[model samples]
Target: MPVTMPRMGNIHIPFKALFEGLGIDYIMPPPNTQRTMTLGTKHSPEGLCIPFKMTLGNLIEALELGADKLLVPGGYGICRLGYYFKTQAQILQDIGYSFEMIPVGVSERKFLGIMEIVRRLSNNAPWAKIVSSFRFGIAKMNALDNVERKVHRVRPVEAVRGTANRIYARAVAAIDRAPDYRGLKTAVSGSLAELDGVARNEARPMVVGITGEFYVVLEPFSNLDVENELGKLGVEVRRSTFISEWMKFSLFLNPLGINEKKRVQRAAAPYLNRDIGGDGWESVGEKVLHAGKYDGIVHLAPFTCMPEIIAQNIMPHTEEQIPVLTILCDEQLAKPGMLTRLEAFVDLLERKRRVAAGTAKAN
Candidate 1:
């Protein structure tokens, strides 16, 4: 069965592990490239979030490569995401591309229903084997999540620029190629070693803590190549929220009746609150926390995202001690201009940091 999935930043590692463990053969669409964007825009409905456009593009690419099935999650709640699977399926069917869709969004009863189907499709594979595969997938996913947490710490360090990244890519490749759980575990562990000697901020640059909606933060193109642009400007970027963090939060912290927006607000409580929009409370709070540690806070969002709008409005009041650059992006973003702006921002922050250092030295 040909499998397909969405592209999230640095997420290829775990996804590849999961599919490989299931012994599924699938092809990932090319990296979120310009062509992918073009295809997505051409086919996607107008006025959707940048993420929807990019995802449509990814699906188009995969379909063109002869994949026979698409794997997308069906979300729930008041979120627009809850309807993505059905909508996307209808859209693709209308476009004349026929493929089986394996959407994984179901209630507990439905989940059991789906599991039975999966078991039947698996030709009644040994239950223990399936459980073992699941365990291995979860372990490898954890390893990959750990790698992301640690790799983000590599900033302003004078080391081989892409060494950690290269090792990560190799590890993913190894996992994708591994035929069993043991092989997958070894490959994942080996990739973790690739991060050794990766340095942290010794001579710190303009560090910015980025937090926002999951799809916005995880998908690079949706945010105008955020981390890469910041890194190019000699800025060390740290993301406060991640896929794994979100998952864990849901399992533990979510029991308190907090949604994603509320969680961010709580995380940023020491900062400020504004009449802003969406997760404004949280963004402001994070800015407050990172004020002296980093140069600024970048509140990223899709053009019309409500939570980020809330965060953006309140961010200014989050203690003007540190600047906040609230960037709202869409499909029409200009990459070069984005890079230039980042360079200028980092330059300004670096100058400020140096002046602060000199004043302390004089004292």
Candidate 2:
């Protein structure tokens, strides 16, 4: 099938591992770039979200690179995502690309759907082999998130601004080489130890929690690598959701008697008691959960993303009283303006910090 899929942050690493272990021919679309965005922007519907545009771009890039089959996540549920595959297929065909689209509808069909896709792609491999491959992929996913979490904690405090990023890239490469859980553990621990060796800085940087749409949260291209930019600004960045952890909870554990979704719902209960579609519930919950810890919250979503728009409106009413900066991205090159807003937000947080410190001294 020469399977291919759009890149989503560190997800490609684990997926690469999965395809290799499945004994299947696979092709990874080239890393996202301005060219990729431009290609998508040229063909995409004007009002579609950034994620949709980027994934379509990724698909086009993959096809250009000789990939003949596409593996896109899908579901039938409370969002437009459910229709992405159908629409995307029509678009690809109209554009004269000859490809097969495999919709892995895990959310709607759950285990059966995933298994069916696996069974088809695995080329009649035994269930035992498929499970082993899946387990290894899951391990790498967890390890990737582990290293990412450390990056979030260490970036702002590193004596050298780019040290954490350098170490993290090496760490991801190491994890990508991991073949088993034991190897994954070694890769994760060794990389984390490397980060621990980064020289320390004296700055007590403000922490910022980033929450919004899942794709923007995970895909750096979609949000302009907000984490690295924040680190350069000496702000510690924490994300509310990790795809690996969420996958473990939602796909594997939830079907077997675990409920991470409910916990997020519980945390957001005071404000939004239900899923408003597409991670809105989690956005609200993250603000409530991290209010006391983060100096502020930054929400990133595509211009027309309704779920995030809903969260954006409700964020101010969150009892936490934490300030929020919501950035709506689109196909346009908005990095310069976004950077300006980020700097201003950081300055505001710093002034608030200084004023609060003076008040504390007076007390």
Candidate 3:
């Protein structure tokens, strides 16, 4: 069966590597576009979050391209994300598309659950092959994150506008085309070198932390490419989430007696004190934990996301520790408006930084 999955950031690159290594034919959904948002919004309930609408559109497009099966991430949690696949499947069926929907419940079942899905998809492929393929996919994910981190750092300092972003784009394509571990390593090293070689100024840019719902933080389209805009404003962005870190905590570390979630919960104890579902606790925790390290924080939340709504309300209480600017995202949010808000926020941080420096000089 030709399987398909939703696009979230560079996640499709790793998934493509995994499916190919397993000898399974898969069709990647097209990139998220205005049409994607339009289709999803037309079919989805008005109150649903943006991620659901976008992923639903991806499935519809994939099914139309002759894919017979859909692989969607699933779990049971207070967040509506747990039920996304089921809801999307029903919507697709109602739209008259017939296909098998497989919900990979990695959140609850962890590694073994993912292994079972791989076996089913690959027709019981040998354990050795499975491990090898999984490792390659993980390597690609790590490589993507590594290069992305570099791009984030370089974007603010690069002398020429858009140079880092252009190189980062080519890096993603190179990483996607890598066929083995050796090729993957080469792609990462070369990309990092190129980013480091970009001409840059010695100016110290104000650092800002990005925290909020996972989808909006990871998916550029969902958040209006907020990180890129921040970089353009000469602000260094320190994003709180990465797919590689998420995979490690969700799949590998949790089983090995390490509980990163508990650590984050402890950080959030002073504020949230409990998991209100989704990334609410994490959002609050990240702000508290990184309080003085970042000059400011930009919190991106999808419209009507309860977890983030709670976080947004709670974030202001931490203003004494760190300043925050919350941007609510949905189909209605436009680039010009977002840019205007970002510019104002950056200006505020710049003034605040100069005041702090002058005060210290007097001391």
After TM-score superposition, what is the CA distance of residue 148 in candidate 3 from its true location, in Å? Answer: 0.4
Cα lDDT computed for each candidate against the true fold = 0.67, 0.86, 0.90
Candidate 2, residues 1-363: lDDT per residue as tens digits? Answer: 588999999888878887899888989999999888988888889899888889999999999989998989787767788789888899999999988999888787765677678768878888888888877888898888988999988898998778998999888998998877888889999999998888988988899999898999899988999989998999989887798877866666565675766776788898888777788888888888778888999998778889888889988997888889998978774889989999999999999999999999999
lDDT of 3 by residue, 6-58 (tens): 89999999889989999988999999988889999999999999999989888
Residue 341 lDDT, candidate 1, scale 0-100:
73
Prediction-by-prediction clash tally: 10, 0, 0
Per-candidate RMSD, Å: 4.3, 1.7, 1.3
User: In candidate 3, which residue ranges exceed 4 Å CA deviation?
Assistant: 254-260
Model 3: worst 10 consecutive residues (lDDT sum) = 253-262
Model with the higher TM-score, candidate 2 or 3: 3
TM-score of 1: 0.79
**TM-scores vs. true structure, each candidate:** 0.79, 0.96, 0.97
Instruction: Return the candidate ranking by TM-score, descending.
Output: 3, 2, 1
What candidate 2 gets wrong by more than 4 Å, as runs, is: 254-258
